[model samples]
Target: AGYNHDADTKAGILSACGIEAGPDDAVNLNNLDDWQEFYNAEIAS
Candidate 1:
């Protein structure tokens, strides 16, 4: 099971291109490759 709206996940969404996320940003799920890159950085730090 996974959270559909976790705070950390939302924060990650906001980190995209250093852009601040609005309500609509969290809804964009079209970039698994980019998200995986973000995940890698998150885990490596």
Candidate 2:
């Protein structure tokens, strides 16, 4: 099976990492916020 990353999932990940996403922004791995969010979340979980 494949995994999917949705908005809430990204948000939760960001939250867990102590990072915040802008209201008008979406999570993209290319961006620092998103990258850190993903990294921290992955390690945290």
Model-by-model lDDT, in order? 0.54, 0.57
Task: Flag clash pairs in model 1.
Answer: none
lDDT of 2 at 14: 61
Cα TM-score of candidate 1? 0.33
For candidate 2, lDDT tens digit of each residue in 1-45?
334467786677567556686332343422546567676679757
Give the clash total for candidate 1: 0
After superposition, candidate 2 runs with Cα above 4 Å error: 1-4, 22-45
Best by TM-score: 2
Candidate 2: residue 20 lDDT (0-100)? 82
Among these predictions, the greatest lDDT belongs to: 2
